[model samples]
Target: MTHYFSWLKNPDNRLKLLILAFVITLFPFVAVSFFAFPTTDDYCHTLAVKEMGYWGYQVHYWKTWSGRYIGTLISATQPLAYDSYLGYKLAPIVLILLYVHASLKFAGAITGDKLAKWQTYLLAFLLVFVLIAELPVVSGYFYWYTGYYYTVADIGTLYLLAYLFRNYSKLSSRNIVVLALGIILLVGMNEYTLVWLVVLSGALFFFGSVVTRKLQVKYLVLSAVALVFGVLSVTAPGNAARAESGLYPTPLKYNLLFSIKNSLAWQIHNFAKIAPALCVLALVLIPIACQLFKNKGDFKFLRAHPALSILVFVGCLYLSYFPSYWSIAEPPNLRGQCVITFWTLIGWTYNVFVLTFWALEKGYMKPVEPGKPVAWVVGLYFFFLFTGNFNYRSAWSDLLTGRAARFNKEMHERTALVLNTREEQVYVPKLKNVPYTILIVNDETDPAWASVEVNNGCAEWFFKKKFFYK
Candidate 1:
């Protein structure tokens, strides 16, 4: 074991091993994607876009449902819009690849060429793996076309952040245009990410001006662009229409207070649920973070005002939650929660890295050397993650138990049945095996359930006949 650990210490060898592990970890998710089927909102969005031209669909959604201009455009162009089931199956695979690519770019940019390529890849892989494995709702973000706009917006945000971090010292005209376009598109994508961009851009401006004592005009410009788009998105007539349809109808003051309270509560709840896994992740990250810190310059702002840094981290969490609560007087839905989980994981890891560097700089703790124990910890973490994590386990289970294939067959059969049936209302057999990782919400015998009703309506619109489960 000592010899094995020593061999693994070679950077090239480690990189190869990590790559192998990533492929192994990713295979089940990708394999199962081929068997995944759209449900609920996926059908609804596809049917709407099919009925309306792309531009008309966008305008209709803006007037009645959402002001997410970019999101509406994305939904309108989903693979189902063209009746391409192959494209639907491939969407998750494309998204997962893009997500990892964005993560690598962001990780490399933030590290500023200080760490070796292997170290950067390791960091990116860990972040991507953890976020994917522990999502609050895997199908919502990964398999469902309706919710993928959030993922695309997140990828765009990462690329934008990478550009800013890589070019912080100077900004050319081209950079300014790119920044403006990125901010507009991101803020227009969805309210959840719009609020995130607002908070992040505001922080950049504030920290550059006051904390770091260096005023970066780029941050100010970015903030201004984000705010302008934010206003356009928030003030859309559809926003009020949607709000009125929300289950909770509180006054503005009460809503604000409740949002704040719920924000705190939800983050705490999420943290508590994932605390054990976080500890293991922290262990795996400590040695890597220590090495990254060695070549990177001091964390001057974080070191000088640690309390403020911590406060800002917590504040960002609150702001992320506020949009959901304010919009509906409730916590974010599963899809929104998945984005929150991603941000929280990234933010928490950054805090840990910063704190570790601070402790070492202050001589408050000894530097943790990487060796046999680190290798064992990493191996164990991956082992348990594959075996225990809900997403991975569920993916493997769906594939191994034939649930994924069965679900696909049933859905295709339903499609065929709908196409052939001439009756005003088509009754299809209920799904016998629902794949947990592929289908977010399945239909029921009764079409009166809210989600089922939406699905049935979409089917009716698409096939020109009502749908029901026998």
Candidate 2:
């Protein structure tokens, strides 16, 4: 691994290094997802798809009308939605690849020289770090459809922004179509993503126009269409229905100010969990990105004026979660955390890039000094900080995998019992660890167990019967 990283640092090699790093980072995510068994929400998502043929048009329309979560309903009813977790997960993996591809090209476009292979690898490192640090339940982000759409799919949309930024110059038919579709899908992912995407997209359009001294008509049109789709995404009739149908009570007035006010404390608390990582990223990644100081005085630019960097970073930190607190009724959930964390990463990256360019444009930077100990210290710090928080081995045990194993064993017994008797109530041990915050199974009110069978892959797999904690 040391040799590989050393070779990449040479800056002459093409981006082949990123492919290797990408695959390595992807391995455990795939492994955990592959073995991931369907949980409570997974069952409901499968049932939505299974029951699609049964729900009349009016009923479907009514459901969609009440709840504006078109993305959720669309993903829920997908034929491949609850297929092997690996298959369902391919979408986000492909998005990550697109991010790497586009980000490299975009950086190249900015500097008039293609980004070095190692830089791309650094981005891959940051992406994985963002994923592990911000997730409330790692498996749900990759494995469960509801969480997958809100978290992975939404983050994928954010990555696609890089692709758009890279290719926005072209007026090709393919680019137009892809951009439009991406906007709609992004809006569909959830409202928080919708708000942030629109803001970022609009800002990018404004900056591109100002920098080039020419209107980017394509991007302007793209931003306008994105805004339209965003409105449609949130106001979907189904959203209202879903909101009413949900067990949680809606506020009498739905005050936007109240939601924003109430969510600050929680979002602030969420930042506390990963502030160290964010600080490390702000300090280390910015200089590397600027390329002004490569060795001993690599951090001299930052060290010269520590307060300015902190002020800017603190601003980025607030802006990261600014759009997140608009839920208006309650605190944003885990998936909301996913969106906020992603935007935070994007905000940090964007801020660093801006800082680098400003420093270069104003000549407020130091000369590069080669063969310095500082580089080694920075490298060690990167390794230490990243390795400290991210633990794939620990994820296997902490994420309810053992409970899944136990759940599998109980299934064997449950199946045999059904074969021998027509019992109405099937007593089973309660699952101690459910992914996310949901109960393992809502047996008290939902007696049919039909949803369970669907998550198990249809009724024949396990006869329909009530299940309860022993």
**lDDT by residue for model 2 over 322-408, one digit each (tens)?**
433443255566666666776666656655655665566567874333234655765576556545544444444433455434443
The best candidate in terms of TM-score: 1
For residues 282-321, could you state the per-residue lDDT of candidate 1 as single tens digits?
8866776677667545333224345555777788777777
On a 0 to 100 scale, what is the lDDT of residue 428 in model 2? 51
**Top-scoring candidate (lDDT):** 1
Provide the TM-score for each candidate, comma-separated: 0.91, 0.72
Candidate 1: which stretches are off by over 4 Å?
1-3, 212-215, 246-256, 298-305, 360-366, 442-456
- Relative to the true structure, candidate 1 reaches a TM of 0.91
Taking all chains together, the TM-score of candidate 2 against the true structure is 0.72
- Model 1: lDDT equals 0.77
RMSD of 1: 2.9
Where is the poorest 10-residue window by lDDT in model 1? 443-452
